[model samples]
Target chain A: MDEAAIHGILSRLLMAGTLPGSVKLGEHRLAEIFGVSRERIRKVLHRLGHERLLEIVKNRGAFTIEPDLREGRVVYEARRILESGMAAHLADNLTEAQIARLRQHVDAEADALRSGDQPTWLRLSAEFHFLLAEMTENPIVQRQAHELISRTLMLVKRYETTAGSACGCEEHRAIFRALAARERGKAVKAMHSHLSLVETRLRPTICVEEGPSLEEVIAHEIAVYREANGAALMAAG
Target chain B: MDEAAIHGILSRLLMAGTLPGSVKLGEHRLAEIFGVSRERIRKVLHRLGHERLLEIVKNRGAFTIEPDLREGRVVYEARRILESGMAAHLADNLTEAQIARLRQHVDAEADALRSGDQPTWLRLSAEFHFLLAEMTENPIVQRQAHELISRTLMLVKRYETTAGSACGCEEHRAIFRALAARERGKAVKAMHSHLSLVETRLRPTICVEEGPSLEEVIAHEIAVYREANGAALMAAG
Candidate 1:
């Protein structure tokens, strides 16, 4: 596999919080799993470390961060500040088409919730913030928002119960409604409160002690990644 | 000098807009100037490239970016969004002591302006936003704000005439007043308009063709860095 493919699989696996906090990602093991050289795996691991997705220890292998509630508070507060500003900006600046697109996204979130598709609802709920960031059409804002949102994803995956994610769809819709109405203050308030609520929803869960082996998790992530890129992989080959 | 010192000097030099955009930063040349190995200079250059401070061209060398007015607009819009959120957060969160500190800082700016100390006023003006970011007490917000603020410093250096920066003190005082009064919406509006006014003040100036040689700029930056770090360096030695 190429470095980007390896990085992508590892990034998703890490962000999904599937691996236990105690599991150290050994370069040799990753190289064997990906059918690549150790050097290549090492490079990708260090890159992920730089991105703060993985914790790189000198002489020790890479490990997943065990983000505590304190860190979660910091991350959520950051999102509140950034996305609130984003909300206010979009309130004043979102175009008619952009508003319609937001409405469609919120509707999709509602539909997923109604259909009892928990996974889809969760993903859409996260994408709602990302969509707002994109609509800002500012690359810097998009980049900053992407980093904070990605960090929160890890936090959400680890701390939030499955039931906790269910109510987020409505919160996202509220934000969308405020933005659509061009109510800047309301939109900012909605976003800030929604994120604060999400932060409050985080409950400490025991890291899975025996859920899945590292190898099993890696294989599953690789398979999911390949399936998602199947058509592109085929075309390239 | 260490890699960080080298990086600091180069960063300040580049951000100061002393070098013409067309000047290529050759590794060997920088190595000689800093009395470091070419490899060390190469590393610092690439690091700066990663930070978007310098552009590293394939098979060529690193060069300063020539940010146009269009790029300035995007950056200012980003600052407005992020700092507006910051202002809102501070409006709700600034403690009495923090408010006092802000008051003192604004007073200092006004004093600097009255004393005809344009340079001090300019530096204090930029630090006002940074101070607000630091007051947010959120590392993520601080990091994001620092990056955006640093980018604008470059834009301000390149495009803003000296006279244009003089009026920013009052705008900053307006933001401070709103934040001190804990007026969330007013604070956000003050910040947004202040940044918009700053952006509108940007004017295209011809890149100086013969102001100073690259060596002179680097030497001057190094001297400034040394003077700033004199105490720390002396302590370490």
Candidate 2:
């Protein structure tokens, strides 16, 4: 029932697009689903509201935020600044263990992409940058980078039409190669171009005229997500 | 009763050194002072604990964090990286209005220093860097800079011994002069040296053999802080 646990669950649901933009959050159902009290759910909702992931109405309830073009650009710009710094640091301080760990993540991303698992591919792609951040050995910068990456992921989930196309496997490999070679300028350049490519690939989805009910939206999104990933929808439950 | 308001109040008290290191927070007293319920105060205290400003125990109440040298160094390092980035960006994007604002803040810092107002001097010194961040027009960088500066302030309060020596007026003037002249290299060098000087000046206090009671400790700290700045204790009340 801690706020962090609830936040992780809610964030996962948001990433899976189970709670589409403007869909109402059913507090009672969420409390039941999480096996926590209504008050605990309220706290999670309030915290998410502060994070700009949800918009809370006075009489009604919280709804998922509809990502806009401005927010998308801002998040991507932040990612570029933070990750470019990480890449530069990693190039200067690249270690065998860190390089091995990053290669492992890149392998996993390739596997997910090969299997056409969009959700897993997206998760691994994001994890690659986080792993780069951890290699820098600065917890403060690592934390800021993680927050910006998560926000950018949320924006991507809202706008992305084709998941596998957003992150090119070769760009990650190019950046890793540059870091392994201790080319600081090349690593920074690769990171910037990689992020720019990801931003370019994100095209906003078409909006539907009629907004569906909360349960219907969640179920439909879950179905589509499961169908795309070939995984059971056990995360939300 | 919101977290933002409570955080602001606690942050100010921490900055003013009215709540010294390891002083146990009186939840009941704060609830009465803020005119809120105990639960609301607990939430704020819990959040502060997460922020490393307070240490919460299962049986014992939360106590203000006794910052260590490691944290002090880490905070200053983060600030240098962030503010140096801000200075470089501002050099490229400096406007007449921005220059005027920067000069105005520098003037305030000089006035505070001349008047021997420790609290105002500390506040303005911190605001000078924050103003530079705002001039970048990048909200994400601005937010990260604010957090790092605030955390650095917390560390400074815990370790700083000299009243008016931590931030020198001439250093601020030098940074302004460099920025006004549009010398990017000089600006970054000035900012980095200013932060380095501040870090070098922070000397930790010696630990006493006997510990004071919670109320006595808070009262004594408050008295010392107020006498140092010629301010009433109205901020807490």
Go through the candidates in order and give each one's C-alpha lDDT: 0.87, 0.73
Q: Just chain B of model 1: what TM-score?
A: 0.94
lDDT of 2 by residue, A1-237 (tens): 476767766766665454457877879987876667998998888767755667888779998877666778877766765676566657878888888877888888889988888779878888888888777777888778777787777767667667447458779989988998889778867987898888887786675545556556545654554464454445444
lDDT digits (tens) for residues B1-237 of candidate 1: 998899888887777766667678899998998899998898788778867788989799998887778888988888888888889899999999999999999999999999999878878888988899999999989988987888788888778888877888889889989999999989999999999999999999875766777788888888888898997879899
* Candidate 2 backbone collisions, by pair: none
User: Which runs of model 1 end up more than 4 angstroms from their true locations?
Assistant: A26-43, A57-61, A211-216, A233-237, B37-39, B58-61, B235-237
Q: Could you tally the backbone clashes for each prediction?
A: 0, 0
DockQ of 2: 0.31
**Per-residue error (Å), model 1, residue A184:** 1.0
lDDT for each residue of candidate 2 in B184-209, tens digit (9 for 90 to 100): 76886798789888888788776434
